[model samples]
Target: MISGSIVALVTPMNADGGVDWAALERLLELHIEAGTGAIGAVGTTGESATLSVPEHCEVIKFCVDSVAGRIPIMAGTGANATREAIELTRAAADAGADCCLLVTPYYNRPTQRGLYAHFRAVADAVDVPQILYNVPGRTAVDMDNEVVAELATHRNIVGIKDATGDRERGRDLIARCGDEIAVYSGDDPTAMDLMLAGGKGNISVTANVAPRQMAQLCALATAGDREGASAINELLTPLNSALFLEANPIPVKWAMAQQGLIGEGIRLPLIVLDEQYHADVRAALEAAGV
Candidate 1:
């Protein structure tokens, strides 16, 4: 299993909303140098919803080529449409991505059977290893544990990024499907606890800003070192909460820009972080020593 902190990277953009290729390359190098286990290119944090199909595939290919097999690349290939999901997954595989993360169909609110069929169809169509993403708060469709366990039986379905943030439910999912597939925490604040409960790793947004620290925390937590992990998690908890202050990349992008990692560019429907939360976020970053 690909373990440790897998950064859900942000797609750096120019002020004109164009993908900043230079910044993207720098960010990739940043994660690799920081010892991030993998890079989740074009995932939610990467603004998968906004990128065009060609851009999405191009980003994945860019990451794969830039990394040069140094570490695994988990491409975000999920879509609300089954055909699009399959096409994206195929594109990622062709781009030589190590794996793909497919979020549940958003706005579709697929039933359990529909969810199973949707994921299965993609897994069957593409040969790449697939990781299921369950973030109902964003997608509005929840994949039940029983349904997830059923899908885990597929040879190509290697893992699930459970972003539910409910430790009890996460523990139950681990017990139910841990034997069949690796479980990864997609929720940052509760990530350490989930890892200590046998989660393989974390698909994290926090790593976008504090890659080195998040990587260290994941290593400690997954290795069963509660004290070491707790120390880091406690420090990161505030930043983790702060990042979600206005939904995902909004805050994380601002945080990254503050550190001079990227520019102040966010796509439409999602503007820059509010000035009101600036002090609080900056304080959190300072507290976490980012």
Candidate 2:
């Protein structure tokens, strides 16, 4: 089962608008040291939409190569086009990623039947494990529990990253799907609660900054130690709210640069975290003792 604090990592960039492979290597080392359970490349947190197709494949390949075999690399290979998703998933598998995370088709906003067909097609195309990503906030489309349960029956459709943050829905999914589908929380704020109520773990944004804490929180929560997990989660509440002060990688990339994890360069169309939100993000970092 895919479990524990899986980090939705940010793609590092250089000043001249190129992928900073060296910085990415360092970030991988950091996560490994911090005990991140798994790593995701080219997800929303990794600024996948903005990256060119070649860049996307390169990032996945780089992550897979850099990590070698330390931890499972779950490549974000989702695309609005089924063909594109299949192409990327095949590349990820060939590049050595252990699994693929496929988000529902955005912009196009397919129906539940379309969603099932898209995922099923990708699973059929690739032999590796596939994890469905359902983040309606960004995609503007939600995959209902029934659809997920149906998809879970596929041999390669192994799990899901539930970003909806609806505990009731998540609980219902767990009760219904049980061992068939491994449900992971994609929303960091409610990750502890979800895990306590039987989620597998979190595919987290918070893990970018507080990897050790996030991993520990997931560990504690997964072990059914609600008290311990809650204590650590409180320390991360500020970070959870702050990193999202801007879109995603904007604040997260800024926070990582503050700690010298990456350079201070974000691609165009997406700028640095606004100056106005600096104090709040910094304060949160301090509060979390990062």
Candidate 3:
């Protein structure tokens, strides 16, 4: 089972917004050595929104090569356009990705019917395993549980990364679809609770700095040891909230830089973490024992 702390890894970049290929390899090796369960390359945290299509594919190929079968690799092939998403997913499959984490199309706010059609189109088009990403807060459209259950029946649609952080909804989703698909927590704070309720794993941001802890937590929670998992979860609570101290990769990129895991570069439209949040993020990292 591909169930554990799958880090939504941040792609390393230079301050000038150039893709730092050297730094990228270092980040991949760090996770592989730290025992991270899987890697989600070029997703939101990797600045996927800012990269051109070639750059996006380039990053995915680099991740696939850098990891070299050491760990599972899920490429961020989601796009606002169904055709574009299908094209990217096909390319990722060609690049040897284990699966594709396709987010709900953003900006256009596709309906439940549209969402189903969008994903089904890709599933029919690609033979690789596919994980649906439902982050309504970012995508503007919330895929209802029924929609997810419907999609779960597809041969190639394998699982979902639910980012809503709503436990009740997550539980219902699992009850409806768990037998057919994997239910992964995309929100770090509630991830343990979701796992305790039978979530398969966490596609985590907190794992960026606390991989070993998150991996342990996932193992414990998946194994039904709530007390042990919660102990680690409580310790990681500060980081769960603090990482969003700014928009995603902004704060995470900064945290990674602090530990010298990656350079402090971020793309424009998004910048480095604000000065005010620096000390707070640092304190949170310290609290997580990073």
Candidate 4:
């Protein structure tokens, strides 16, 4: 089980909107020192959509190299196009990522059968461990738990990152899959609850700035120490809410920049965090001890 607090890391960029290689290495080192369980590179938070294929592959490669086996890496290799997803997953595996996180095919909104087939195809093609990412809010397509259960049987499909933030859905998925597959919470706000309820871990955006706290919360929750975990989670609630004040990585990138974790560059189609929300986010970060 790829369990614990795994960060959906952001791609640091320069003022000109290019990847900041130095900052990327700095962020990786911070996570390593803070005991982050795993790193999910080129994820939505990492702005995978805007990056070209070569850039995407390079980011994952750079992350794999940067982590230096200090922690596991779950490379984001998903694409709405099945073939592209397969190729990325193959590349990630070749680059020595421990696993691949493949999100549901977006825009086209494929049927449940198509979702299963899509994931299965990638798993079969890559021969690498795969984690199904179902963030319907972003992808416009959700992989039903039934389909997830079916895919859980595939040899290489090991788990699902349920980002729906629905406690019932998380519990149901965990129940249905049993021990065959792991259930990870992709939503930070509800992560502790899901972990206490049988989730194997959290693929967290909040962990980008609050890695140690997130890691500690995951440990408590995974141990079924509900009370202990809840205490830690209370400290993080503000951060969880604030990071999504805008469509993620926007607010997160700004907060990280303020903390000197990364530079202030965010690409187009997605702008920097709005000024109006700055003070509130700053307060949240201060409150969370981030």
Model 2 stretches with alpha carbons more than 4 Å out: none
In candidate 1, what are the lDDT values of residues 1-290, reduced to their tens digit?
89999999999999999999999999999999999999999999999999999999999999999999999999999999999999999999999999999999999788999999999999999999999999998999999999999999999999999999999999999999999899999999999999999999999999998999999999999999999999999999999999999988999999999999999899998999999999999999999998
Clashes of each: 0, 0, 0, 0
The C-alpha TM-scores of every prediction are: 0.99, 0.98, 0.99, 0.99
lDDT of 2 by residue, 144-207 (tens): 9999999899999889999998889889888878689788999998889889989989999989
Candidate 1, residue 79: the lDDT equals 100
| Tens digit per residue, CA lDDT, model 4, 187-231 | 999999899999999999999989999999999999999999999
Tens digit per residue, CA lDDT, model 3, 92-140: 9999999999999999998899999999999999999999999998989
**Stretches of candidate 4 above 4 Å error?**
none
lDDT of 3: 0.93
Which regions of candidate 3 fall more than 4 Å away from where they truly are? none
Off by over 4 Å in 1: none
CA error at residue 79 for candidate 2, angstroms: 0.1
Candidate 4 structure lDDT: 0.93
Higher-lDDT candidate of 1 and 2: 1
**How big is the positional error of residue 230 in model 4, measured in Å on the Cα after superposition?**
0.7
